[model samples]
Target: MVDPSPESVELARFSLWRSKLDCAFGWFEDAERTIESLLSPQAQNQPETLPFMIFIEPHLPRMEGLELLHLLRSHPSTQALPVVMFATSYDETDAARSRAAGASDYIVKPVDAREFMQVVSDTVARWLPVGSKKAD
Candidate 1:
């Protein structure tokens, strides 16, 4: 996950924990760290065969999620990876742009824990491998 808000990350982490999913996570508030994480498998503790399903907010620093998604698509290491756009508001233009840029999905940031959990459940169901600790 990548967002410019530590509080948001913390809340998401807490929500995941409360839902009883046993997953490891790494988060970033900046583009550089996110890029580094994508480039280095060891940094993320991920096997080389599995690509990351990135959850990134649309409104981020020097490189917004849309631009970053394009970059990732172009880069050999991250090409074919799944990128999910997350934003506070739903803009058709942004959604279209994300689709054009090869985003796997676009999600509007939820205002409450329940909504966020629902999003997580949907995301895991669609993108994660089977047998993942599903949300109740």
Candidate 2:
């Protein structure tokens, strides 16, 4: 998770706990750290270093989400990594921009907890195959 909001991180963790998805994650409120982690040399070769899924918020602390996504896609190490953009905005234009840059999906933050959980469940089930260990 690459969101600056502690609530988002906590909510994600809580959702994971509630769902019992059996996955591990790292959260970076700062985009710079997220980029560093993704571009690290060991990320490609080390199973523990790679992420099963990456969730990014569109409005980051420094760079915008789309810029970061573009950087990730251009990098050889993270080009194929599955990335999901979860944003508060309901604008279709932003969603379209994210999709055009090779994002796996763009989801708006739900107002209801149940709806968010359902979305999370669907995202995990749809993106990560039953037996996958290094995709998200």
Candidate 1 per-residue lDDT, tens place, 1-136, comes to 8899887677677666776665666688977787776766564466453444677898898888887888778876677777888788899999999999999899887988678767765674477656776556
Give the TM-scores of the predictions, in the order they appear.
0.81, 0.87
Worst 10 residues of 1 by lDDT: 43-52
Where is model 1 more than 4 Å wrong at Cα? 40-51, 134-136
Model 1 alpha-carbon miss at residue 62, Å: 1.7
Give the winner by lDDT: 2
lDDT of each: 0.76, 0.81
| Model 2 lDDT per residue over 1-136, tens place | 8999887777777777677677775799978998777776666566557776788899998798999999889977678878999997677888999999999999987978777777776787687756753333
Clashing pairs in 1: none
- Residue 14 error for model 1, in Å? 2.2
Task: Locate the minimum summed-lDDT window of 10 residues in model 2.
Answer: 127-136
Name the runs in model 2 displaced over 4 angstroms.
42-48, 132-136
